[model samples]
Target: MSNVSVCFSWQIFTMESCVLIILVAMPGVWGGAWGVTFGDLCALKGTSVVMNCSYDYPSGYSVTNVGWSRPHYAAASGKWRLFFLSRLPTPPVHFEYVGDYNGNCNLKIHDVQRTDEGNYYFSFVTTLDRYTSTTPARLSVKELTAIVRPSTVAEGDDVSLTCVLGCPARTAVVWFRDGQRVLKPVFQARREDAGRYYCAVLGQETVRSASVVLNVQYAPKNVTLSVSPPRGVVQGSSVAFACASDANPPVTPTAYSLYKDGQFVSAGQSHTVLGVQPSHSGLYRCQAWNNVSWRGVDLMNSTEIRLDVQYGPTYISVSLEPQHAVEGSRVNLTCSAVANPAADNYTWWHKRTDSASSSPGPMLWAGSGRVLTLPAVEASHAGLYVCRARNSVGEMSSAEMLLTMSRGKRGSQPHLIIAGVGGFLSVTLVIALLWYRKQRTHAERKPAVFGSGLGVRGSSSPATGDQLDAVYANVGTSQWSPPLATAAQDAASRSQRSARHEHELPTSDEAEVTYSTVTIQPRNPSFPPRTNNSRAPQKCGIQCLTLMAVDIHGRKRDTLV
Candidate 1:
């Protein structure tokens, strides 16, 4: 027993010398045979921590208790008091002593929190003595925080950011913006850089700082003008216009100005026009402005938009082609009007005018479409014409226009009159000729009367005697002869008497007549008149006997017996 005691004391002395050398090498660290592996440690909040520890003693010593302890401030005593924890039956849910009594003395803390930051000490009890570590294991619970030099800045201005830990320490830091890694923490501010930003330790990506927004001021961009009731703007209706823009500091309502056809109209974010008219239609635009500026200008203009106001047809008129139309010619009547959304329907009306009809005729449906075409115009097509133009809004009728059909070809009126006169003269001539012929025929049918006388002459030749015999036979009554002297004297007297009475003679008809007395003697006393009873002498003394009667009009008729 005395020898064992001597050996134990020798071992204790040697261990003490070794511990003294370790303490000189690493200052502020637990350097005895039983000590923690680290002097200080840092951990993020809500993370687990493990402390490696070990212990040794003299060969004859036996371990009785093993535990950990920390210092807490006691406000009542104005001093730091020690709080102890031991693994009695089991460790707490938040803490565990995984080491055994032989050598290992590892302590684990689950779900480390901000309150867990402090110094920790390990102690053990042996059958000989109780020992505690002189150096403590300091714990630092940290959280990541991001700091910006200026949270808000204008575009093109400089900005800086920093990642700060709750406790000051030398550690690498990384930055992120909107879940994307950032290469640098300092940059020139731009519109694209305005977003949430945070930071984390280099190797501990799970730790992050709260998000902060960076506002970047900029001039208005993408300015645009919008019209309410986008289409189909009609006259006498309300119209609305609104201006919008993209800006950091929104433009004020009073900062908008409206323009039409490059002329200033109104000032406001929105403009309203009541009872819109066709004159109000034009190109419209809006100007937007704010406190921000780009280059040298501050105002921005939107793209021009067209506002069209619709209206019904007006100033209706009809136009006719070939103003002087002739029969069998084509005619066209075109309807025209000034309107928005051009007229879709056209109607033609006709009112006939004629000599037989005194008053104007009722309107008739002539045709439809912009142009009324007369394929083959006739005299019946002559009338007063009108055209009506219509659209979705309203309709209007044109003034009356006259459509006249010309006789024959144009400029032929004088010729027609001359032809009519010639025809009248021809008919008069025909009637005169017929009447003259009838009067002449009636006069020719009348007979005239005159007194008669007979004469006979005898020839000495034998042929003459035969002729006398034939003449007696032609008389068919009796052969009676008178002495030559007596016959000649008697004939002469008769001739004279007939001549004197010829002027005093009258006709049974009421027409004047001329009487003539003819004496017949044989051409040669040998020639005699042949009689049908004598077997008709081969030749007669006279070839023909003609008596002519004359009227006072100088017309004549001849008789042969």
Candidate 2:
């Protein structure tokens, strides 16, 4: 066999730089040729790799066989030994020798795995001699992996993600978050950005990095407060309040707080108040917080709510418009109470006290509503008043109030009696004065003729003395006027004179006589003296005068004057 020389050169490109390798054959091997093959090639897992190789020996030498080999550990020799890949009883299905014995020694591997990484050699045998490449090409299997600058970050912070591979190759990278494609690997972190992320080489869809989880921390949001019983919360009933919020680090049970009327009440996610009352009714709110912070504040508050506690009427009482009630006067009674839900119904009751009994009478329904009005209060209205207030829950009655009525305006009996007596005395004095004046005028006209007994003035006999006495007796002394009393005394004096004349005069020549006694009373100083001409015979004060005569034979005659 002739001495031959073999030489080989190849280039390797990587992400950082490119490398060139040349293998020099033994000095005796001259005019031998070897095809350039890749040096130290890199490939991602689950991908395919190809190694280019060819050989040329003396032109007369015919190619017999070609194969590939890899270094392996030999237990018997206790040293490393070469294992022919094609000589194995069952060759690996992933490996294929595409090159033929004519000098092409290319080898291909599919679905590269970490275990397939190692140095590889190509060998060929001809009719005269056999040769193998001295410098072997190395195969490095790498896997795609995702790298994050910060796995956990606060919202609004900047984040960076990268797809890394040990292999040296410039390939376009694609990023994904929760199975959704992302345009950029670096972005501002937000609440939505928190999720699983991965990357892959642009063309290698099957080559994907392990998933990485992103966590975004932020302050509590959407804080809310809820009541177990939203409506119809009455006194003595239990009530519950629940607080909730959305946050990266969920609010702790102890971080919840309750407030009433802007004042803090208690702490806890759920707060319960037993035996609620009207005093508990006010504006309410809840607050929540977590370790996360935003805008210089770590706590958040919910919108205000109203907690209304229902209750029955309390402190019921009645008020009077006019404190004193009198007959025929206007009066008003008003009812009032303190309650959560205002009292809707009002009732007024009355117990009369005007009865003879000292105790109050039975209570009777007086009126309904907040106010009871009496247009004209009377005696019958005098009584004890009570007001009742009612609501949906219960009812209450006010204390009884006594009402007294006074008499209306009217004249007293004593004053009327005095007025009547005074009027009667004034009428009596006026009549007495007029009568006295008339009597005085009549007496002045007659001038009190001193004629004592019956005188015959016109042949008419005057009334006998006995007849005159009988007439005088008919005039009542109680009814006698002041002037008549004096006339009565004068008649008595004239009777004595008539008796004397009867004794002295003869009985044979009987004569008729008419006599009248006229008495004049002193005139009152309030009246002027009357004139004689005013007292003519036609105007005689005496009502009448008469005279009569009798003959010797018992004959009688009549006369008028």
Q: What is the lDDT of residue 199 in candidate 1?
A: 83
List CA RMSD, all candidates. Answer: 16.6, 16.2
Off by over 4 Å in 1: 1-43, 46-59, 70-111, 119-121, 128-138, 166-169, 321-331, 353-359, 373-383, 402-561
lDDT agreement of model 2 with the native: 0.71
Q: Per-residue lDDT of 356-465 in model 1, one digit per residue for the tens?
A: 86898889999999999997788778999999988888888899999988776643456678888999999999999999999878865744222122222132222332
Q: What do the candidate models score in CA lDDT, each in turn?
A: 0.71, 0.71
Question: Ten residues in a row with the worst lDDT in model 1?
Answer: 469-478
TM-scores for all predictions: 0.58, 0.58
Clash counts per candidate, in order, are 0, 16
Model 2 residue 133 lDDT score = 72
